[model samples]
Target: MTLDPPSTVSTTSRRGTATAATRVLGVLTIVMIGWLGVFGLLLSPADRDQGDAVRIMYVHVPSVWLAYLAFIVTALASAVHLFGKSHSMQADRVAGASAEIGVVFMAVTLVTGMLWGRITWGVYWQWDARLTTTALLFISYIGYLAVRGLEGSRSQRARRSAIVGLLAVLEVPLVHWSVRLWRSLHQEATVLGTDLDVSLDGLMLFSLFVGVVAFTLLFLWLLLHRSRVLTMIDLSAETGLDAALAQRRAEGGVTA
Candidate 1:
């Protein structure tokens, strides 16, 4: 037997809450992004070692963090679908949204990294452990999206894609640990590590933090919009099915 649709009141309230949250987050994101742009681009002191080119860190680091955050959300949503059974469609929708955003951010990270590498290492690309593994991680998720798109049924597709999502998450740890595990040109974690180099300084760190916050808010806003679009598509499909069934019944009645 088919399950009944969710209560209109409950769905409406949830939609309203999501909309408000999206708006608030969008405004906060804009403000934080503006603040970061000014401080990182205009106010932060140039690095003694890398000179003016070091400013790229302000964009590169934040994009990597945002990409990681998106993948984490995708993994969580995939887990919810695999276990909970309920809201599987919603979870899949969220996973899809996060994956798309994650891919974009990952691309930014790679491009920015390449530019930084050219300036410092005198090469556009390197097969260093950290860079190689991170590139592999991004490619793996892109494959997941390709598989998800080709599937037919929502439930079947979700189950298959969720498994891929869960497996792809293993790469996250590998990417994070690659630098420590092997001798690489890439630097270690700056903000969270105990090394505490004073080169970043308080203002630079604060600006980077603001950029992170902005990117996070922007991710949420994008997720909410994508989720709403998915919900609407589902609703449309249901409406179409109902109309088709009604039409079939009407024709049968006329024949009788």
Candidate 2:
């Protein structure tokens, strides 16, 4: 009978679920995002105010929404890691996965916002409160990703990363409310908001909603894959470290 090494153990039930979810989400993302593309780009009527430029909303809104969501997930998971003594590593992995994906989505948000801004605000760049806060938010999380790579013990690394993850999310609220709190060119939320409501009806509204949902599913799919890969990498590293320690002991005349 062939015996599998501990590091090469069969997949857990949790991993199987993540794999299945990734497959399902992949299909849904392709279909829904594709549908949104056609609907937003061609079928939906151009805005009377912004004309074709409004089409950027379908991509921009969803990307920023997911960016917020990703940070929230990271913060929540980080909280668990800090509090949950036994299950800390699992929480850390989820936080790391979601934070990495969040950075990508935040970058997309900045790029798309700039494109839309060029048409609406007459400039591709601005130092408005919301824009400035958002840029800071993006940079802060980039730092969080960087900190994760520094050399440290597992406990020390996890503790530091978890703290950084929580601290990074504090910027999210500031970014969200910056326009409302101060004067800015950026429009307030259409589907979400109180003081600055914009009218979006018919297919335009539907397309925006579909884009949000599609991007959310895409985030989940990406997070699952990323976390799984991280887990495998950690396992391999641990296995290698164990082998090295065992070799050192055996060479010193200790039991192999």
Candidate 3:
């Protein structure tokens, strides 16, 4: 028995699942945001050290985590495009969407981080290790987007962007390790290893937990929507090209 072409199989599967996946992501986004708003705004306890200012973490930390998650998606999609010849086009399109969304989230993370830092660290900017690496990560993607936006043939642009995507991913690991590798004012990871402080009360922890869930669902929803839009744009361009070619052929036939 012959196997279906990899592109045919991949496209078929993605099309079949796209609507359902989008719906699920949308519903989950609503639930997550609702919970986050309720808990983060009204329930989480004030920081004893920073007072209410510490509440920014609910937004800042989650945004940073989601930014990393988005970039990781971009990198994985780019890798698939570069190395998996069979599904290169599909992978590149997916990577494009992921990178676009990743950039948005990265922007949010940087803004929120700066706001939090100003209130807590007593400054709006710092050359701290984590901040610097995060800034570099943001710049790398900005460069990627610039390259992507430049005029080029579709395949040529895709290949070039894929390379950039892969290279930019190097910043992700650096961003994560920056706090550990250098002396920085940024706080270390809290949820992963440390014991929870009981003094803050259950409502506060619960609110933050809800915020994380909400932001994650929101990210998924946004990613799916962005991917769909990119795919539609690609399809529209292909259709326009085909129409132009058909018109030329008709004119030539008439002249003959």
Candidate 4:
């Protein structure tokens, strides 16, 4: 009889998820973050209105932008997983991993915003329209992640979570427009505004630009590692199940 190798034994040959590309990204992310810190903390002048508290923008804006970008990626990946001819589970893994990173970035955005609020608005919490919508967006994605954790076959989980992911991402646009749709205490976009005029000092603009680039690189680095980790996890689980079933069959034959 031909017998398959043990799952654990099969996986033992795989050392880790890291590759040359990931190592390069890791190095680039570290270097960019270092430059971001220098430009944000030392090179850029403080806002005339917000003072040193404005430094928080270096992190805050980039965090929210990355959150938006990550969620969009999750949605796109989900769509491909759901509708594409191949129905690839790789897309599902990407969706879940991106959502996880998005949640983390969203959390960072909220925390930094709160810190900025404490200094400028005199309170760490508010019911402002933009803040409220952003919180909801964060919670909705959290729910998406929870749905992904539900018990099911990989395909089943992927199908249901794909639906949820597509729906959850709808909130992103709402959160973005809430500032303009209502009288929000939250400030409107400066660089992203409809106006062509950007009033930020050259150094401030450069610092903010650096922050965005650094955060984007960080997100890519995280997504690459996370998706690969998820792939390994799925492999281990499937192989372990196969091993268990084979063992059960062997036992039954022996009993017979």
Against the reference, the lDDT scores of all candidates come to 0.81, 0.85, 0.77, 0.89
Model 1, residue 138: what's the lDDT? 89
Worst 10 residues of 1 by lDDT: 1-10
lDDT of 3 at 118: 89
Per-residue lDDT of candidate 3, residues 25-112 (tens digit): 7888887888788778777778878888877878887887788888888889888888885756767777887788778888988998
How many steric overlaps does candidate 4 have?
0
- In model 3, pairs of residues that clash are none
The predicted structure with the larger TM-score, 2 or 4, is 4
Off by over 4 Å in 2: 1-18, 195-198
Clashing pairs in 4: none
Error of 1 at 85 (Å): 4.6
Would you give me the overall lDDT of model 3? Answer: 0.77
Candidate 4 per-residue lDDT over residues 143-249, each given as its tens digit: 99999999988899999999999998999888988887899998887887767578788999999999999999999988887887788788889999988888898
Residues 52-132 of candidate 1: C-alpha lDDT, one tens digit per residue: 787788889889898998898889999998999485788888888888889999999999999999998899898999999
**Model 2, span 36-139: residue lDDT tens:** 98888988899998999999999999999999999999999999999886757867888999999999999999999999999988999889898999999999
> Residue 184 in candidate 4 has what lDDT?
93
TM-score of 1: 0.86
Cα distance off (Å), candidate 3, residue 209: 2.6
TM-score of each: 0.86, 0.90, 0.85, 0.93
Model 3 spans > 4 angstroms off? 1-21, 193-203, 254-256
